[model samples]
Target: MFVSVGVRFEANVEALNMVETAGNYSKHRRVPYIIEEKNVLKIIYVPAVSGESLAHAFQELLAEEAISEKQKVCRKCLRGEFLKSMDEENAAEKFDGGKLPSDAEKLEEGIVKNCTVEDIGGFLYAGKPPVKRTSAFQVSYALPIKKIAIYSTVEPQLHARHAVMTEAGKKTGGEREGAAEQMIYYVETGTAIYGFTFNLDLRAIGLSAITGKPIIPEDELRARRRAAVKSLARMLSSTQFGAKLSRFLPLGGIVSLAVSVTEKPFTLTSPIYEGFEDMTLKRLEKIAKEFNEQYQYYVLGRNGLETPEHVMTQLIQYLKERNTL
Candidate 1:
């Protein structure tokens, strides 16, 4: 249940005892942010009464804040003072917790890992991929496009903007659709990297297919999911996928990698959306289904994921697949 404490910014949950967690933006940190403008800031503060109406409220506030030309101290200076005030005040008073909880303790869902091998030629010899963080962990991956797309509203990761409420945000962030899609890293030897972007409009996205509701409270969700899915996909494909199916390449071409949530309520619920359900199950199921199918082909499609379970099952199948392989 969502505790009505206040609006949460970059917090997420982790997993243990082999439970299935979904929908949290575990990888938003690694998402590259290109600073389009120097010292950029966002409009996030909203009144508690607005509740679910926060997005609209935020929109109005952002416009006013952007135009207000009153000579005021820069945001950085204000943040510094805020920190100083917190120091003078008891830690417990500044934050309910004496100190913020470490990210590991907060992330209650998803597997985090990195590529064991990525900088093949630079880091290692040809074909020898570098060892990265963990599979479930979010890492930087990219895809290059000759052009870009449009979004009615965009939450750009540029200049450190990490999310958006719509698919256009995905396009602006240059993220793929689906958590199963891997984040393709396009090494632009020709041009400056990070300039390439993906613009997705979540408003145009069809979350209804998974959730019964048509509204998504966390607008930046789709883009975060897109980046995370692909990152995990790559980790799964090269690592877990390799370990699991060494002996049988796409066994019977019917290999299916899926998640059997040993957890509660959402293990069965779909991503059809609940504005309240932060972890949507249907979305997880769909991601897993796609991952399983793609494993058969042994390709990640530049940067793509076949399913959320692709990495989930891949992690498990690796142990089983290796024994027989």
Candidate 2:
């Protein structure tokens, strides 16, 4: 089974993913988006979040969920450092000082067996005859919805830090020895309706990418798949997978969401475009008829639509009925 999700959300005064800082001014990540206006093409820079950021958050949540279910997770991944088997030394850490298999296939099997996060998230070992496992899941950068992207804005908000004056500073004419009594900074906050896509290949979990075989037992495979789905549902419902949430949590929930499940791989129309929900429904119908494959879809913006949790719950039920979960 393959699952694809497209999301459109509103974020207000959010600094969820900042890229750089220059002289007390931090900047939000931005990317160029092209659009056509009056028979002319134009490019606009808009605030965005990197796919790396989204992937990291997903893996972190996966680790947490896996551990809670008594599934194996590597030490580094458990601590949220996803330096997945970068080299021999790093791969060995998952084995607790045991010798790592020299054969690439054996190494991949061992790592998949030992770490649910690595199995789902993939890894590349830059060792002799390097081995690579592609991630079963894919995420796209969070970009502003194209229709209203021109109105999206990133503005600097001023903040200040004040320190108590010391007696020595008072004696030195209100000047601290090596520090200022007060400091001012600016945080670039963004407001927009952002869209992103996430896809998970359920067939890839607990399967050996190197040898085209199963690496773990069926029970564990089901557990890992469930963990992956639950992690995504939780992340979207809570909107808790970005930076600076303590102070700059976005003041919005999901504006719309669409999810598709297929027997074969299929991607939904991107939610950044207008009328994506209808487009996705039509495309799914065409693919089902053309390919003669079973598929299911749910959209949250439609009439009488349920919450994200409910939508995911329905998906889990569907997968369970098909014995895919």
Candidate 3:
């Protein structure tokens, strides 16, 4: 089973994913978006969130869900530092003194069995042969929809910090002398309708990428798969997967969502383009008939469609009926 989700959301005054702090100003991540106007091509810089940020949030939720279900999660991943088994020595740390097999296949198996997050999220072990496992899931950088890309804005928000000064410091005239009483800073906040895509390959969960085989038991695989799916559903529904949330939580929920579930790997039309929902439905229909495969699609924010949670539930049910879960 394969699942693809495309989301379009509105975010106002959000400093969710920042690049760096230069002096007292924090910059929001920005990317160049290209568009055509009057038979001419133009490029504009827009505030965006990197795929790394979204992946990190998803893994954190996956770790929490796996732990909640009593599934194995490496110590590092449990603490949200996903440095998964960098080498033989590092792999041993995850096992608490237990040495990992030297063979690449065995090493991959051991890591997959030990950490659900690593199994699903993948890792690269720079050992003798440098084993690598591709992540079962993929995420696209959250960007403003193309039609609204020109209107997207990143503006600086001013903030300050005040310090209590001693009587001597006050007498010397605060910062000019020796003591600074107040500090002003700016954080770049963004406002736009952002779109991103997420794809999950259910067949890859609990499977050894090195040997192309199932590395864990059937029941355990099912459990890990459940955790992986649930993590995504929870992340989207709560809209809690970004940085600087305490101070600059985006003032928006999901404005639109489109999901496609299929027997074979398939990705929906990216939501960054307008009319992506209609395009996705039409493509799904064409592919299903041409390939003679089964698929299901769900949408929200059009014609009073289903909610994200409901769509996920339907996907879970689809997997169960096929015995993929």
TM-scores for all predictions: 0.16, 0.96, 0.94
Give the per-residue lDDT digits (tens) of candidate 2, residues 59-171: 99999989877799989999999998888777886665777877888888888988999999999989866889999999999999989999999999999988888777778
lDDT of 1 by residue, 78-130 (tens): 23221211221212222234343233211111001101011000011111121
lDDT of 3 by residue, 140-210 (tens): 99999988898999999999887777778767665664324478899999999999999999999998886
Alpha-carbon runs more than 4 Å astray in model 1: 1-219, 240-256, 260-325
Residue runs of model 3 more than 4 Å from their true location after superposition: 94-96, 166-179, 302-306
Q: What C-alpha lDDT values do all the predictions have?
A: 0.22, 0.89, 0.88
CA lDDT of 281 in candidate 2? Answer: 91
Considering every candidate listed, which one attains the maximal lDDT?
2
* TM-score, candidate number 1: 0.16
- The local lDDT score (0 to 100) that residue 185 gets in candidate 2 is 96
Error of 2 at 309 (Å): 1.8
Query: Residue 22's C-alpha lDDT in candidate 1?
Result: 34
Give the C-alpha miss distance for residue 115 in model 2, angstroms. Answer: 0.7
Better of 2 and 3 by TM-score: 2
